[model samples]
Target: MPVELKTPPSDDWVPSMDDLPFHRLGGEEEVKALANAFYDAMDADEPALARLHELDAQGRVNAGTRERFGLFLIGWLGGPQHYMERHGHPRLRMRHGHLPVDTGMRDAWLRCMRKALDARGISGGLRRFLDERFANVADFLRNTEG
Candidate 1:
């Protein structure tokens, strides 16, 4: 697709995610817990997927890496730009370029996030929105054949 500019709608029109208030509803603390639970789910339920991560001596995702991603999620969900302030642009696909993100990896990653979302009681409209967004990112990350 090509870039196209158009007149903006009236001020009464609300931006999509802005209207959802996902981060506000989850809060920073809640998002952190969700991030940790996501990694925990990767550890417990998707060992093969977990192999793509850097684990700590305790056999869990590296603490700093986990924290960095948590920071990324916070900003990603319309919160403060902590991750960008400290680490610069996410460049998600570029960052994952070295990983052969095949269909299985993409699905596994989404599965972990979905489980994490479920664990946190994210449902209804918010859940649907988040799931679709996450799935899009996951699919976009794919770099290899099945």
Candidate 2:
């Protein structure tokens, strides 16, 4: 679900997944762990999805891919803007446009993410919120019909 702002402006308004999650989700380190876990799970369990990414000599997603994603997640969770500073806007769909994302790929990606979140012990409302957000983005990135 894209962020919704119901606003004339609440006294303490913040973007969804903004500042609150950054702090509540244990800041930079935990977020980076989540990114790492995501790629690791993809590497282990989703060969088709993993092959779509740049791989290393060991056949895992390359370090650069991991680093960039870590940076992206940091900013996405509102910890820092390093990803934006280094890469400009996320432009997620545009960046992913070259990939032939379809239902299968999208589902594979979500499974990896779910594994990552579960491994991290992410639960409760936070887990639900993240699940919805991830699902929305994954679906949005789909470029072809099944």
Candidate 3:
């Protein structure tokens, strides 16, 4: 005789992994760590981050850049919308409009992001998704020669 398979009970179907909640509160810690890693990579990889460092030196991304980037990442990583709450809409492209973000710059940014993500020990799927999303955002931020 074949046994019948029983269906599991269905509840409200709450999502198991709530990305937003995960990034809120202490979630900002990861963002801060990622920012640190990104900066570290920029400092270490001379050629990759040369242009970015130049821009930073020009005061385009002064000291406040770290704090702002941390806050922004907090929100971007599905944490509390602190960046949006404090700065209103991100207006990413507009904010970066003055910067000369070329293909090389974009690649450098992605490289730093990749290193940071790798350092985070995030799940493979999440890492892949984030990398792709970051690439798209980085590409959108690019406003210079190809």
- Return the top candidate by lDDT: 2
- Give a tens-digit lDDT track for model 2, residues 1-146: 89997754243333464446667679888998899999999999999888988999999999899999999988887788999999999999999999989999999999999999999997766777688889999999999999
Instruction: Name the regions of candidate 3 deviating beyond 4 angstroms.
Output: 1-17, 20-26, 46-63
Off by over 4 Å in 2: 1-19
Report, for every candidate in turn, its global Cα lDDT versus the true structure.
0.83, 0.87, 0.69
Every model's TM-score: 0.85, 0.86, 0.72
Across residues 20-84, which tens digit of lDDT does each residue of candidate 3 receive?
42442247777787787776666666444544543465433345667778888887767778888
lDDT of 1 by residue, 1-146 (tens): 99898974343433265553335446677888888989999999999888788999988888887899888998888887899999999999999999999998999999999999999887766677678889999999999999
Better of 1 and 3 by lDDT: 1
Error of 3 at 37 (Å): 1.0
Q: Which ten residues in a row have the lowest lDDT in candidate 2?
A: 9-18
Comparing 1 and 3 on TM-score, the stronger one: 1
Q: Give the clashing pairs for model 3.
A: none
